[model samples]
Target: MIIASEKKRVFIYKDTQLSDPSINLSKEAVLNFYANTYPELNNATIDGPEIKDTELHYKFLSTLGTKG
Candidate 1:
């Protein structure tokens, strides 16, 4: 039996000064994906992604039968 492991890469962004990140997909690349494969997007333009800030609340349960 023979097997090969795939290569892995990591990128760290420290100070590009971008308020947000615009990752790999460029205009041409997105247009290509929209034209060729993903018709269900309803001809949407290739705008960059959006991130929403949401607050999460969690309660920790103590073993003493109390909520912490």
Candidate 2:
């Protein structure tokens, strides 16, 4: 998989302090995190910022030499 297009950011905020901290992190940063967390997934890209509760998730797919 590839990063087919530029990231589309969506600001998330929680009015109460109890909520998790929010920040607009780049896709590359997130991907790097996953890559570091799980060494086996060395060549991968992230897709989608699927928001659930107060968290953001992405679809981590391994790169198979495909162009975006």
Candidate 3:
């Protein structure tokens, strides 16, 4: 996999072959892997336009307690 740093215009190539199933990692180990890899993005913030429509998209399947 290839990862690019948009700000720095730097790129990195990852070797997928090295990630064999024989090598097992714990949850903490996996989290630490990502933490150490991208220290800059650890606590990044974002600001964007808020979502206007706060509605449920799907219809409710059951109304067991509803009264007419």
Candidate 4:
């Protein structure tokens, strides 16, 4: 008997789709990793892990707006 040991995780930031750099990193870690390139993510929130096909998808919801 054998078991599958791999699952793909994808993160969506605005108009960009980022691939997981490492399999061991947590979702939050992935977010922090990309924060260097996108500073706005520092205050951002995580959305879904919507499953599509065989991949896990996440969205970085930006919190960069003013209250009217």
Name the best candidate (by TM-score): 4
Candidate 3: clashing pairs of residues = none
Mark the regions of model 4 whose C-alpha exceeds 4 Å error after superposition: 1-5, 65-68
lDDT of 4 at 1: 94
**What's the lDDT for candidate 2?**
0.49
What TM-score fits each model?
0.22, 0.41, 0.23, 0.84
lDDT of 2 by residue, 14-53 (tens): 2211112234546666556555655544786656578666
lDDT of each: 0.30, 0.49, 0.29, 0.90
User: Which should have the higher lDDT, number 3 or number 4?
Assistant: 4
Of the pair 1 and 4, which is ahead by TM-score?
4
Clashes of each: 0, 0, 0, 0
1-68: candidate 3 lDDT, tens digit per residue: 99854221111212211121122553234333444554532333222223335421211111134358
Residue 7 lDDT in model 3?
A: 22
Model 1 pairs in collision: none
- Runs in model 2 lying further than 4 Å from the true structure: 1-22, 50-56, 64-68
**Local distance difference test, candidate 4:** 0.90
The alpha-carbon lDDT assigned to residue 49 of candidate 3 equals 20
After superposing all C-alphas onto the true structure, candidate 2 shows an RMSD in angstroms of 12.9
lDDT tens digits by residue: candidate 4, 1-68? 99886658999999899999888988999889999999999889999889988898999998987879
